[model samples]
Target chain A: MYKLYEFFASGNCYKLRLLLTQLNIPFQRIEVNILKGESRTPEFLLKNPNGRTPVLEIETGKFLAESNAILFYLSEGTDFLPTDSFEKAQVLQWLFFEQYSHEPYIATSRFWITTGKAEENREALNQKRAGGVAALKVMEQHLTEHQFFVGDRYTIADIALFAYTHVADEGGFDLSKFPAIQAWIKRVQAQPKHISITQQV
Target chain B: MYKLYEFFASGNCYKLRLLLTQLNIPFQRIEVNILKGESRTPEFLLKNPNGRTPVLEIETGKFLAESNAILFYLSEGTDFLPTDSFEKAQVLQWLFFEQYSHEPYIATSRFWITTGKAEENREALNQKRAGGVAALKVMEQHLTEHQFFVGDRYTIADIALFAYTHVADEGGFDLSKFPAIQAWIKRVQAQPKHISITQQV
Candidate 1:
């Protein structure tokens, strides 16, 4: 059996949990409350010196952190990772997009809004919210014709982006503005073995 | 032929250049000067919407961004990526470590210190420098025993970590404190096809 150390609300963690369910892989879930600073404790830091969440622990007790990286780890040699060279690179491209362009804006806005800290830095939060919308719009434009993120199939790329994008509403970004993204989300949820983010493995 | 779009001084770009040399993979280097804001132009953004480097343009003209992602792409189905399941995960583990823990601290501190922006944020820069050194110390501990980042072999894990760890001194973290890392650097450099970051493709 494997173990997943995660925060309930994290899209990064949720991405991995969703993959586990879709793959029918059995794993124990250990909740690390980031709001309570559980990740900073010596015990947790020993597992991942970076002090972040969504670490996957294998049966041998070795811990792997970073949600996208864990998704790669689990998806290797599977259909989730495209076998074609170009398609594979495309997967990596979108994963990188989710990190640099998308996460910085979208995740930050979600953090500020959901935690109700947006009032403290209203101007900055607003700017971030706008940027988040911009990123979502990029996805919306792409999703208009494509059923999934990279290829014509469901992949970790979709899982990676969907984790945060689906929750963009919590960050005060209006999802209704992007009908393509709305349709794409429904398409993803319609997949077999799909699991909700809050569900336990 | 493969082409790499990169900035002259970016470690992210340098990582790919380093790997290409080691693998004897011929590539044309296209320099995108970041200081002049070349990455923001519409033409560059079309290649990579995130507008960062290094973007590896395959023979098909499809571009790929994100340094770690590019590393994974080029190294796939090759010896640079580990074949074993757990070893492959370990490679990803360190790649993620480089991104989350090492890059935020080490790369940022280096940018501030080397580029002489430390005066503008001396206190904050000092705090970051300390954090960067702490990360280096963690690497020192790991390198003290392991020959490479994983499985006693030179994989992309070493390539990813070495890109920054070798030049961490530019970040204001004294490398002399970590003799094991120095030894590890020498080990990586001693490899048959290893190339210095200064030497461009």
Candidate 2:
């Protein structure tokens, strides 16, 4: 069986779990408390030099890191990842956008705020607030015209973006302004195998 | 015919040009001077709402954005992209690494320094310096053991990384310590149809 080294609360980890559960693929979930520095331990480092959680251990020794990369790998040969060339690129476009543009601002703010670390770094939080809002604006604009992020289908791109976006309010981002995104969240949640962010494996 | 909306000096844009040249794929280059806010204009926003350059006009009225995503799209079915599932994910892992870990530090530093803006943000440069060093160290450690990033063969993973890495010195990063990366740079250049970063389409 595949093993997932993950922290339950992390959206990055959740993206993989959500996809696996949707596909009904079986995998073991090993909790790694990042807040406790468990991921930085030497043995974990041996598993992933990057020292990150949500690592997919293909077997005893083989492993894969990076949440989006894992999503791409697991979604292969499935309808989750679009096969059309332009659609594939667009899926990847959103994946990169999620990492570079969206997650950095939205997820970072959520981590800092929800963990009660927001008090110490008001300046940093303020800085991230604008960027997080900007990312949402981009999504809001796109979600308005299209139900999903790519190919008008429920795809990995939606899963990748949804991981952080649905819980964006936890990061202190108000979702009230984005009606399209609000509806998209419900649409995703209404899927046949939809799972909550807090759901355990 | 394909058209690339790009800024000549951007390493992100350079990655696509480099690959197209190596693949011998013909494309028209339409330079968008980002420094002048060209990318942010309404016209460009229609092409890519993200308002970033290196937008690939796959056909009239159809476009794709994000540099790494474009590379993946153009490289499909070519030897540049790995065919195996695990290997493709490995390539993506590195691509994500290049964007999140490597580019933000190394590429941003280069932009700030070379554009005569480094003086205003010495603290930011100093902040990036450590992260940039950390990224390079990771590359050095990996390259020391393996000849290429994902598999032994050259792939778009190398091209994505090479875009910024080859000119990391412009960012005030010292590559002298990374003997393995230095050697890999020479190896990439030694490949057939290799083009310089400044080479026009």
Candidate 3:
């Protein structure tokens, strides 16, 4: 059986859960409370040296960390991964962008504001927001013209970026500013088997 | 013609360039100096809104951002990307780890020391280094038994991690601390088309 160790409200964990639901995959949910430092415990750290959440443990006891990785794993051989070589690479490209560019700005800002740490570096937070909004605008522009991030259909790229971006407002980002992103979010939500983060299977 | 817009010292660009060399793919290199903020110009941003280094311009002038994406594009349909679904996901898994777990810590620490930004946040810098070192230890433990990152083969996973890690000392990381990684670096360098950042092709 596949078991997912995750923390609710974490964009990273949410990405994994969303993909599993979209694919109709079955897995047990193991909650790790970041607030209580459950992930940092000796047992959890043994499972993941980095002590981060959203680890997928296969039946063989092998575990996979990193949300995007889990998405790729669950989405493999499915429509979520493009067959064309270049398009497949494009999927990876956006996934990397989600981590390096978008997540750093959007996810961090969300973390600070959601956890009430935004006031300490409001100026820096705003600067990151400017950068994050710029990133969202870039996505908005591409998404406005294309149905998916890489090709004509939904891929793991969309899943990876969709995690934090859908809730970017919690980080004090004004999603209403980017009409294209708003529409793109709707398109993603409209997927036949889509699931929200708060859903229990 | 396929033209690669890149900075000399960027690991992301190096990953692409190294793959191009390995594949013997013909491409022209156009320098974008990150230090001079050339990537942030209107002309460059038109190619990639992220304004980051290593934009791969395909034959149709279509620009591709992110290094791993470029690697996957250039090495498409080749032996570089595994055919098995799980194996392919494993590659993505390592690549994702390179970004979230390894890159943020190792690459950022290296950049901090290389560009003399370490003084700006010495405490935070040390934290990143500590985290980066912790990550390297994971690699060390893994490398102690395996030659490549996953499945005993040289894949883009190695390329992504090798980019910043080979020059970790530039970021004030003492390579001598991790003998396994040091040996693994040599193993990668011994590849048929291995290229160094300082080497001019």
Candidate 4:
């Protein structure tokens, strides 16, 4: 069984949990309180030198870090991932977009605001709001034309982006203007075997 | 032939250039001067709504954005990408690390400094410097134990990371302390058909 070292509140960690449950893959979830610096311990560092959560122990001692990479790994040869080379790369395009362009602003802002660091990060939060809004506009533009992030089907790309985007309101983002994204959020929730971010499996 | 819309100075764009050259794949380079807001123009926005450079035109009318995604697409089925599931995911792990942990700080700092905006963005630059250093430390840790990023062979992961890391000095990041990364950079440069960032095809 796969052992997931994760912080329960992290959207990155939730990406894996959602995928694993939808895939029917039985995995053990070991909560790592990132707020408490549990991930920075020497033992956890051995599992992931980056000291980040959502480390998937594929087997004992063998691990994979990076939630999107873990999603790619588990979804390969499955319907959640596309078989066509171009489509596969398209999936990856959005996954990278989520990590690079989307998550840092949306997820980090949510982290700061929800974790009681909002007052301390006021200037940083203002900066993040611009980036976060820009990211949402990109998604809205893409979602306006397509039903899903890749190939008009729900894939890991959707899962990756949806993880934080659905909760962007908590980050002080005004999603009311992004009707396309709001509609897509409903569509993602309508997927088979879908689970909420905070749902325990 | 692939048409790469890129800014020559961007390490993100350079990743594709290096891989295309090394793979011996003939590609047309269409320089999009991002500094002049070319990427944000309506016409270019059709190519990539994200308004980012390093958008790969796989063919006419079909564009792939995100530098690492383009690298994955171009390198697929070639020796540059691994076929094994685990190894392939490991390659992606590093690619994500590059974009999320490495590029945002190192590459962006280089952009700010090299473009002469360092003075105006002094506070932001200071924050980016810390992030860039932390990212380098992570790379140094990994390179210390392995010759290559994944499966002990040069892959697109190296290409993705090398694009920024080799030019980190321009970002005001001192590489003197990261001996492992320095040695790995040399190894990456020594690869067959390797090209410098500024070398036009």
Residue B167 lDDT (model 4): 92
Where does model 4 exceed 4 Å of error? none
User: What is candidate 4's TM-score against the reference?
Assistant: 0.99
lDDT at position A111, candidate 4: 97
Give every collision pair in model 3. none
lDDT of 4 by residue, B11-93 (tens): 99999899988889899999999989999999999999889998998889999999998999999899999999999999999
lDDT of 3 by residue, B8-64 (tens): 777878898888888888889999988889999999998987788899999665888
Report the TM-score for the A-chain of model 1: 0.95
Error of 2 at B121 (Å): 2.2
Highest-lDDT candidate:
4
DockQ of each candidate's interface versus the true one? 0.50, 0.87, 0.71, 0.91
Q: List, residue by residue over A1-201, the lDDT tens digit for candidate 4.
A: 999999999999999999999999999999999999999999999999888988999988999999999999999999999999999999999999899888999999999999999999999888888888889999999999999999999999999999999999999998999999999999999999999987878
| Tens-digit per-residue lDDT, A1-201, candidate 1 | 899999988999999889988888988899999989999899998887778898888865688877887888899888898978778778877886787567867777888878878889687677676668768867887788788988789999999999989988877788999999999899899988998877666
- Where does candidate 1 stray beyond 4 Å? A116-134, B112-127
- The interface RMSD value for candidate 3 stands at 1.7
- Tens-place lDDT digits, model 3, residues A1-201: 789999887989999888888788888999999878999998998777678888889766588878887787787679888877677778878888998878889998988888888899787687787778888988988877887788768788888888899999988788988887888889899998888977876
Steric collisions counted per model: 0, 1, 0, 0
Superior candidate under DockQ, 1 versus 3: 3
Can you write out model 2's per-residue Cα lDDT over B55-81, one digit (the tens) per residue?
A: 999889999999999999999899999
Chain B alone, model 3: TM-score? 0.94
Please tell me which predicted candidate would have the highest DockQ against the true structure: 4
